[model samples]
Target: RHGMRLDAADQAWHLSTPTPYDPPLTYGGWNQCRALGMRIASLLDAREQESNAGSGHSDNGTKRKKKKHKVVIHTSPFLRCLQTSVAISAGMAQFEAPKDRTSSSRPRTPSQMHSASPKLPLGSQKRYRKTKLRVDAFLGEWLNPQYFDHITPPPPSSMMVATAKAELLQTEEVDTFTPTTTQRTSGGSLWNGANNRAGSSRESPLDDWSHVTNALLHAPIARRDRSNSASSVGSNESSGRKSPFRPKSPFRHGHGFQPLTSTMPKVEASTYYPPQPHYAISNSDTIPRGYISHARVNTVNVDYHWDSSRHLQEWGDGGQFGEEWSSMHRRFRRGLNGVMEWYSQHGSEERGEDALGLEQVMTHESTDDDDQEDLVVIMVTHGAGCNALIGALTNQPVLMDVGMASLTMAVRKE
Candidate 1:
């Protein structure tokens, strides 16, 4: 207390206090402790008042603090730093010492200010040069992944790709075989995509591919001639060929259709015309071996047959067949294929002088059959209603004697 330099005014103010002052300490410790306690209490308070004579009066305590500036603080910034550090250390000690904050709550002082606080990411200390420098270095690798990581391209979506055009065109052909117009199978040429392959027709690509090799080598004319000669040779050798599968010839009208060998051969009863080089309805068949041919040509197989009564009612004595029927039958005959006719003789007047049959085989034509069989004879004589059987043993007609002399023969050699 004695060490503190108080002015005369301060001494008078202290003497005027209502509280009785204790006697000074043996070593003056009591007065010094009281003075220190009063100083600390004054700093904790928001305002200081001088009782006998107060000189300052300012709002919000700013003027009061200025007037109480009797505190000759060691005011250097270094001293301020030191004071903050000391106060913070003392508070930390109190905190670590388990002082109940709720009971004797006290304000703490802040210390150790850096340039700035750390930003968001881990290890990003604002004071650490490496982290700050790395943050500043980051460019736009965030926005574009392609620039960051390499990527292989993917297949285009359907909407993104345009389709290719059809490679083949369906060109028509003249069925030189049938003397009629024909067409080539383009096999859905409009869409030739690899993904569009379907069942059965998937083989079309394989077949077409085989043709491509030959197509690359041969010119049109050379290919055409080759195809013709190959076809003339046979069908098996020309399987992979690209040339036309058909050829033109008015004299040839049939295709690969052969007479049904598995069934019985019917005897045709019409005005039949044996095939001629000039008026061939169709081409001769390429018959396979072991197949016995049985054909009925120029004769239509119908459920209802023309009876003699109907025939007589139409044109009594004109002709056995009507004119219109004759014309239609002729047209059908002309357009018929593989037409065959068998002959029977009963006085050669055939059924009433007008009944007709197939023309005879040309004498100059060469025949394939080597051996001739026994002639089978059948005749409707002027007699009772009955049919007779002929035996190969004696070349004799059984039951009735209307004999074998009138029958003609056509058969294969053994």
Candidate 2:
């Protein structure tokens, strides 16, 4: 459960609230979420210690079993949920060291040996392997397009690509500007210095670099066109066709040429300096594949909460004063069942078994002297969904308030 936080403006609108803007989590909400995560980790630690004390020691008191703790975190795609997961992960990490924290007696790698030290520092060479956090996009607010639109096409122009790269590479300065409608629609403005219909140019000052380079490259091509036209006129004058050497603009759209857009602040250059030559191919073009071809694809299934039911007009107004609550409850239970099935399947695959009960799959404990294992699953979700789930699990209506970032614990007892 997320802690106490104000709703986003969009959420407020859906709820018919007066506020029009989404509000971020208050300072208290943020702190509460962090504290809850830390508390959960502490409680788990104490429980593990108690279990070990009761089961691990032998009668002779000469031998004791060892244990390990593992935490698996799952988060909804919502920003608040993701933030909560981060807070929880930080809390859990504070209690444990990396599995490879021990240093070798002697340097294992040649690079380490080359250094003056004969042994690596503790935790210096250790690779801390924690369970990968899973983002359940399906768990996002229902009917939100953000989670569904997984494939976003890149900008079409090379100029835009270069500008984006420059922005990424030069973080010390802001090198990008919001693109105008003309820049997005008309490809010709990039090649020529012609102003759009607005009569004002929004080009970035960095475009001066590209303009100087292009002018130099175009000069030679213009000259060659002139020479060819002069020679062709004598032979083709009788045909009455336009001259080929008329020196037309070579920076046509779809010619594989990318125009540079202005983004950075203006810099003065010497008038006497020769204009820089523009290269035929841009850095983006040199890449082996197009943006769409190299787009990454991820297959994930998320389970959103029933609070998303608010999106349905029929479910609004407290689901017609609790009359529609049963429908909402059913939806939530179905989604939760799907999640449990997935966990069961995943556990089976890992253990090479046919299937495992949800409790057995989610809860892990180890008693081996060389290995200690504990598994914790943290789920971040909406208030309505959290309350409903707790009610179903405990077989009663939720009596406690579920605030933003608030936490509820359920431990399976053997």
Candidate 3:
């Protein structure tokens, strides 16, 4: 998934997803999930060895080898989760396959490829069973009853028409810049006006609003960042290493701060409040007098009616955007507690059975009565869900945040 932004009225908010539009994983997201799956498989294999080492001796002093366990994979019903499970399975399969021990310089022939399979690690004749991944809807993102009336079915395909529109907007440029008066009032009115005009019954208007907002506000930021980076940097004359300073201007490339120029439109301080000073410029020792710094700000303007449906919360102090801090904290805490309760009862059991079955299948033997296996649960969900879960588990408030397609892992030892 990639990053996206929503625009309503004159205010815009940014959102990140595993896919550009929704419901699907981007190529990067897919690869990251796949690699994570492989890593999990490797960890399981290592754990299996530890289990074997602990139980290698019988009561009568005879040596016996333990079987490798089976892997049971469960995923959320979301399209991205399903896709991630598939990638992970592929990674596990690749991990299970024996590697060629020949030198990297040597090219393997068909005969070499068809040579007798390598002996099992423990001199056993059993083959590892493939991991079976299952999709479960209950393990999905935390759904607030106040927000959604019922569970929505997954879209037929993750591919979105809006994705095409977004791409088109990325390539298209808007030359006509209409300067509007920036009032001191909280930007909530911008979204309120749009929602009032569009009506609550309509969905198309909201989609259009988000699309147009992305095009008008988001696209420009992306384009400007890309352009500034390309323009500020050039190849070094002697050594090939990237030079820290640029030749044309002393300012760092893509720093988001630009020198005030005659060509740029003048801002009326009476009408517009320039954004808070960025730390980079504010902390600098030698300040340039004529330079004006531009800091990227995401202004979320959600309709009052859809407050329950929206997942965005006021972060940190919450005073920055005039959002109610207590309300957001309560909501987060409730959602997290609910998820933790569900996971403790169901998620733990499913993961244990699946992982044990995988071990048994791979080693072609049942687990010993005394052998306890470590369980690994991989959950794919939204940012809020992830944050809440982590906070609950760590017994701390949510402080760290993850980006789109980011992987977070937790382990439980027996």
Best TM-score goes to which candidate?
Answer: 2
Misplaced by over 4 Å in model 3 are: 1-21, 58-67, 96-128, 142-376, 403-407
Off by over 4 Å in 1: 1-295, 298-373, 380-383, 387-414
Off by over 4 Å in 2: 6-24, 55-65, 95-121, 124-131, 137-324, 348-369
Evaluation by lDDT, superior candidate among 2 and 3: 2
Q: What value does the lDDT take at residue 180 in candidate 2?
A: 43
Which prediction has more favorable TM-score, 1 or 2?
Answer: 2
Worst 10 residues of 2 by lDDT: 291-300
Task: Indicate the residue-level lDDT of 11 in model 3.
Answer: 28
TM-score of each: 0.14, 0.41, 0.37
Residues 273-321 of candidate 3: C-alpha lDDT, one tens digit per residue: 2232233332212212211111001111111111111122111111112
Winner by TM-score between candidate 3 and candidate 1: 3
Model 2: per-residue Cα lDDT over 1-414, one tens digit each: 765444431333324433222123433454456567557767876776677667655789755655545555555444455445544554443344223445645447776567656344543432222333544422333322242243222222222223322322221221223444433334444545665333323344433335765776577532235356455654454578766644433233223334544435454321112112233323212112211111111101111121212331111211221224455455445555555555545531142221354434443333345555545566676666676668766778774557666677776444
How well does candidate 2 score on lDDT at residue 258? Answer: 49
Compared with the true structure, what per-residue lDDT tens digits does model 1 show for residues 1-414? 011112121334335433212111111121222233234324322233332135345465533322221110110011111122122112211221123478336543455234434444443212100000000000000112232132222111111111100000112232222333343444543223344323322222323343543464464533344346544434534565444433442112322223323233444321222122233322122111111001111111111111111232121111111224233232222211101122122321122323343221211223224212122221111111111112222244334433211221223234
- At residue 42, candidate 1 shows an lDDT of 42
